[model samples]
Target: MSSNALDQFLNENLEDLRSKGLYNEIDVVESANGPVIKIGGKELINLSSNNYLGLATDELLKEVAINAINEWGVGAGAVRTINGTLDIHTQLEKTLAKFKGTEAAIAYQSGFNCNMAAISAVMDKNDAILSDELNHASIIDGCRLSKAKIIRVNHSDMDDLRKKAKEAKESGLYNKIMVITDGVFSMDGDIANLPGIIEIAEEFDLITYVDDAHGSGVTGKGAGTVKHFGLADKVDFQIGTLSKAIGVVGGYVAGKKNLIDWLKVRSRPFLFSTAVTPADAVAATKAIEILMSSTELNDRLWENGNYLKNGLKQLGFNIGESETPITPCIIGEEKTTQLFSKRLYEEGVYAKSIVFPTVPQGTGRVRNMPTAAHTKEMLDQAISIYEKVGKEMGLI
Candidate 1:
């Protein structure tokens, strides 16, 4: 093939992304990711990140990663099925199971891959998956890969979930039925009704899957949404990421030993991909230890969250209903939302705007992630910027 073919393919896709306004231009962070970050030679209060507990730059986690790197080289050599299952991997899985209050756990290279691996491993063409309309993209892809019949219920509408579950069960169109939802909806920060989901699952005998990517280290006093609702035992699969709050890279599925065992033997990712680095495994384990030691970080995180949320609401910005730290300043137009974020950035705040297809049209907004590391002064400054931007944009 001619080299022009590759160039043509790239140019066409790049043009399409630009036309859609979804071609995100990369911004270089000049300093460590934290409450305050240096970008474009300007220091700004960072409101766009997933480092909830601020452990991404924590000294403890750094030390653990360093020590682990010193002890065991860098990569894990091969797939877990071959020789990549290191002792640290097993230790991390055990620690995760204990942290999530589950009987067993399995780890994957990335949270995204965890969904790709676990969902396909258990459910297939003959299965039916009842998912929330707003579930994460990873979950949607996982369901598609499973070749299962996917039925989306209204966001947090337990009645719809129940009706669908009952219908799927009675129809006998599937060999198995499963319910999947995000423990915390990332966009709105609204928590899933796990208790209601469990009730429906029990009534319908459906498998329960909770993806707590945004909930872990932020809810349930740091354990996650399942623990928040005391459904750790009731939920069949408790999915989580080690990257966000755990300050490392990888994903996990916590559930009964049988489910994990089945995944270990069948999940293609685990069988084909190399395990996480020793440093990542050790750092994640250390992060979990910190979470288990006390709720101090979790409390501080919420404190910062509430402080920022209250300030934003008081500033007359239409922040939607959110029970978690993920706050969105609802600016209802795509261009306006993007402009609001740009204005805020110019004013020394680094919050990014999320627009259509990340969310429904006309519900675009700038999402703020307040971490435990944010000081009161930092939040106040952010509030001031929001007020100025809101006034300038006539969004107030």
Candidate 2:
């Protein structure tokens, strides 16, 4: 029989989560994840995907992916350090370096693995990492895996970062210190102050790392956050995901050639884990080429974002401070936020509610992600549904 202790622990925690309205119930989409999705035989205006530029469903990308499958087959069949390093993989890395304005780059199977691989490869128990409190969960796990002394700094507070950096340096207890942050805070959707952070990094001689998973295609004219602030040569580690804006799978680190070389040798994930599929590599390369060639998709994305934000604001909803396209409509309680999302689903919109644990308590919200693929007509329909649901629930 299965272990009773383990089963009991899971059952109790699952029950607790359900009772508190914190447990998430995932929905399956029958159709492609595009501007609209089919869930349980009902169509919805999908405003909850990370497919920012809508390249996931682009005809060009789909064609390239099919070509790649025909040419390279499906899988790489080995870890990167083994025989998995295909020419397309190298091409993808080179394109990523150019796209991010970096000297060289390396690829990983997932953005989470990029962190899990890169951070531990560079840091150790002898080192320390100063991280923003609002950074992504992947970042937190990566820092933990490093076995470094993880020091939490106040979110986007330059003074607190400087103070902590100074203290960590002055104590001389650690051999190296790294300050890591997200280029875009995903939940609240604010850009990171890279210039300020770089200034402090210079003063402290600390390594700088920016995970621009949410900022890459949406910011910097589609180059990324590092290039957005013209600090391309200043930052040490630039991390991004191919799945989000690139509309494929995998992640990468763009930096100096030596750093990438070192990671290829030392990063456990690269040495042990299999690389991304050939189709993913080829599709991502084509996506980056599209972004670097033009900003049409990026512009359309911003227009849709602004249109939706204005619609929600005019209808009397609290959208938190978001400089980027990610918009969150704040609902005070967990249950209420869940109810709001449910009502939205019933009204043919598909934005999900983020509750406590993902965010702080009493600050739950239904996050909306508008894509380049969404037309003005689709956005208008979504806004009308939001208004209908909001008024019925007394939210607006």
Candidate 3:
């Protein structure tokens, strides 16, 4: 028999979650997660993927991945410091540096691992990290791991950030001060005020770090938030993911040569964890090439976002204030949000409900992620379905 104490604890916790309607019921996708996805044998207008450029199903990437498997096999075989670090790994890093317009770049197993690796690689208990209030969870975990003095500045509040930065610099308490934020605030799709944040960092001599996971293939014509604001040379640490927009499986940090060199020698994950597969590395490199070569996909993405946003607003739904393709239809109550999402799925759209504590209490929403691959016809049908469901649920 299983341990009685452990089983009781787990069962009690699960029951509590279920009673509070907090337990997430995951859906099984029966096919590729593209603009359209099949789930439970039913197709949907899938609006819940981070595949912003729709590169996950791109023929070029698949072909390159298959060829890479043929040439380099399935895995890297060992930790990077041991027998890994294949040629594709090096080439991918070089291409990423060029793509981000940085002096150098380093790769990691995942975006979360990149943060865990980079933050602690540079900081320690004696240092401080001034982070945005709404920065991603990975950032929070990284800061905690470093044992850094974390000062959370008000979200997107320049005055608050400036004040905190000044106080932290004058405290004479920490060895180093770093200002970290997401390039794009994931939930609301609001672009970070990088120009303002960077100016404060410069004044306080704080290291500037931007995690551009969501913004990499969605902003700055697919270059990212720093390049979007034309401050590529000013930021100290630029972290991004190969998984989301790149449609592969890894993460990276691009910065000055010294930082990259230091991370290579110092980051625990890089030394201990095995490198990404050859297929992932090469496919990520090719995706970067596509983004660097043209703006067609980027343009299409923006166009789809605008179309959907306008359609939602016209139908009387409160989409909140978003400047990116990530959209949210606020449904207020947690149960209401879940019901709305369930009804929407039954009606053919595959948008997902995000409730507390992914968001704050009573601010639950059905998030929509429109991609470059969605056609006009698909969007129009989705909009009509939203109208029908919104009326049935009295959301509109």
Candidate 4:
């Protein structure tokens, strides 16, 4: 009587997930997600957030957000195409272009939406996208929405990318070809070889896009991976997030003035969705300003990252070969990965396990994100707990 078909479908899917041990129970955070987090009244050392520079809890950002709320109120009231494009929004875009060393920029409600808007804005069924096998989910979705012919390139393999680029160009099956990659892959924390990618793009005349979500505040002295390699002008579409590292909520695309203008007119999300709150725009602007003004927070983040990576490696856990601070303590089976993370949680650490299909099967790992905010004392306690748990589970 009460939607029996929908109920059956949901019940079957839920049952299948549980039976396969793929179901996850979301935890409730009882406090701020800082270097440490409180959940179920237990304070645990937090290594899971993407808040790299600890800007989310910084006093300066908070004060600026509060001031913006007082001055501009909360909501943007409408989409950017209508009446939502405020002065602060324009300021944020200008500041972001400066940060990325680009001619202009445009903002979206969130990073995921930025992808959805930017990709579909320019690409269509006649176009093609050469994507990294390890690119983020948002990029994958964006490529799909574009209706472009998607060709997966091997991870960080310049030769493979080049071969595919040549093949795609010669196939004569597409109008425009865009090669997309994540500036810093989130799971392993390895940065994309932007220089290698740019060389190929130049040779093949491919539009280059880099999603610098993880790399923006964490790499290139807080500018990003594209700038890290000095290819800011060479790259085509530079996508970033206001949430991660910037410590607020929003997304943006920075590029040539013409491209941004096209996006402003054509990107569906920017056209349809309401703009971000004034507080978000101003707070993100302030955070970017802090990053541009100094590298103190960036230094701290790298130092903390190195400390965590060294501690885990010395303890004999197989933290994979990572170029950045992201550490993954591999524990093969899915159930073991989940159990290891649960023990870490109970032991005062709160790293989470990533399993298939987020990653390949039998390569399940408990990933760690050491931030600038984590003190030496907190890191030491976490490492000691890792040692205790590793021995208990015979993982070391």
Candidate 5:
């Protein structure tokens, strides 16, 4: 294709995004992403970060990262299949497996890449995958890359999943069948029906995959959704990220030893891409250790989440049914949702607007991530802002 043709296509797509009100304007976060952040020279109570445990700014994690840098230097020189598998990497994986109560674990450079690597590595063109309709974008892309026939079941609808699983298995149209879902749906903050899904998977003998990105740090007593329901051994593939609850950057899959071994050899990101930095690996390992030691952070996180959710509900905002630390104040229109977010920013809260394509068209929301570090004072201040902005916009 000519360069001008490609340019025209790109321009048209950009215009389409703008017309749909889906073009995101990037904000420059001037400080570390924490409970409070500086953006555009204005400080605001940040409710948009994934640092659920507040580990990103934790002195312990920072000290560990710095010490690792001093000891191991800055980067891993090559991919894990090459010379990049440092001792810290193995330690982190082992620590993760222990933390998650799995036999083994394999780490990827990022949570998104973990999906891209693990999904395609295990399931191929001759397979069929039954996925949740509300799964993360990474799960969708990973399913596509697998070249499997993707069947999206209704969000958390056990009957639909069971029906599809049976149909896929009976058809014999593929070599394998797998069911995948996000343990906690990020947008709605609702927990997946994993216990029901596990029962269906057992009935159909289907491979099981759960991306517990949101649930890892927030649910199941800090182990995750699998542990929450005592389905650890029942689920085949358990995926999580070090970035969210662990307060670092990286992703992992924990399961049987064979599965981790298989991913180490077959997952493209593990085999081909440069590995995570020594600092990141070491820091993530320490974070896991902290999580294993106590449920203090997790307890605080839930308390704050409940406080915020109750406050929003009492103020008459439509806070969705969330079972985790994630809370969403649903507004039905894209323009209104964006305006609401803008008003919150002006009033000094930093929750961002999530709109169509991310969620369904009419389910636009301002998702709030209440962390362990948020104090009662902070929660009160945020609720006050939410009420003021919501009332001003006639949303409450």
Candidate 6:
């Protein structure tokens, strides 16, 4: 029998969430997660994927993955420290380092795991971390895992960061101080002020870490935000994921040779977890190579993003201040936002609603991710559906 107290706790919290309309019921996709997807036997113009460059279903990547599987079989067999460090894994790391213009790079099982492993490996109870208010959940968990003194700086507010850095440094109560932030804020699509942050980091002599997961393929002409700002060599740790724009699975940290070397021996995930499969490593490598070779897909992605934003803005939707392709159509109430998403699904669009805990309360939004694979026709149809639903729901 199940533990009664555990069961009761889950039941009460779940029912509370349901009653408050905050419970998110996930819809399973019946087809490939591409520009279009099928769910429940119905087709949808998918605007909810992180496949920003549309390489997830690229022909060349699929071919490379197949070849890799043929050569390396399925799994890596053991944890990286226990002889699971395959040649393909090494190749991928080298390619990532080159792509990010870093001296070396270390790959992890997943982006979330990368954060969990990398942060705790270097920081501990004696250190302090100054984090942006809206950093990703993984970053938050990673900081907490480090058992460091976490100081929250206001989102994109360099002034707050500077003040906190000053305090953290002047106190001299900590052995080390680190400033970490997302290169691109996923929710609002705003870019971080890396120049200002770097200046402050230099002033305070603090370590700098930038998680550019959403910015890798979508920013800097596909190089990333660090390269975009010409600060590639300045940031101590450059974290990214192969799962998003790269069109595969895994995460990585690109930095100086010494840093990567330290993470390889110290990061818990790298030491204890088996490496990504041969296919995943090769596919991710191929994706990065493609991005490095050409910016065609990146251009297409920006075009689509601008096009979608214009259409929604013309339709009188409250599209937030997103400097990147990740657009959020702000719809005030939580239940209303969910209803709007449901209406969108019914009308053949698969954009999802994001509410509190994911975002702040009463600032619910239908987040739209426009990828490179999307055609103008699909976007126009989605916009038309938005118009119909917005009119009927009196949202526009």
Clashing pairs in 4: none
Cα lDDT tens digits, model 6, 198-274, are 99999999999999999999999999999999999899999999999998999999999999999989999999888
Better of 1 and 6 by lDDT: 6
Q: TM-score of every model?
A: 0.97, 0.99, 0.99, 0.99, 0.98, 0.99
Report the alpha-carbon TM-score of model 1 versus the true structure: 0.97
Model 3 misplacement above 4 A? none
Query: Which should have the higher lDDT, number 2 or number 4?
Result: 2
TM-score of 3: 0.99
Pairs in clash, predicted candidate 3: none
Stronger candidate by TM-score (4 vs 5): 4
Give the CA lDDT, 0 to 100, for residue 336 in model 2.
95
- lDDT tens string, model 2, 175-195? 999999999998998999999
Summarize candidate 4's per-residue lDDT along 1-396 as a digit string, tens digits: 689999999999999877765678799999887999999999999999999999999998999999999999989999999999999999999999999999999999899998998999999999999999999999999999999999999999999999999999999988999999999998888899999999999998999999999999989999999989999889999999999999999999999999999998999999889999999999999999999999999999999999999999999999888888888888889888899999999999999889888888898899999999999999999999999999999998
Alpha-carbon error at 222 in model 2, in Å? 0.6
The global C-alpha lDDT for each of the candidates, from Candidate 1 onward, is 0.93, 0.95, 0.95, 0.93, 0.92, 0.96
RMSD of 6: 0.6
Q: After superposition, how far is residue 221 of candidate 5 from its true place, in Å?
A: 1.1
Lowest summed lDDT across 10 adjacent residues in model 2 is found at 73-82
lDDT of each residue in 1-396, candidate 3, tens digit only: 899999999999999878877789999999998999999999999999999999999999999999999999999998888889999999999999999999999999999999999999999999999999899999999999999999999999999999999998899999999999999988889999999998999899999999999999999999999999999999999999999989998999999999999999999899999999999999999999999999999999999999999999999999989999999998888988899999999999999999888888999899999999999999999999999999998888
Clashing pairs in 1: none
lDDT of 6: 0.96
Candidate 6 ranges beyond 4 A from true positions: none
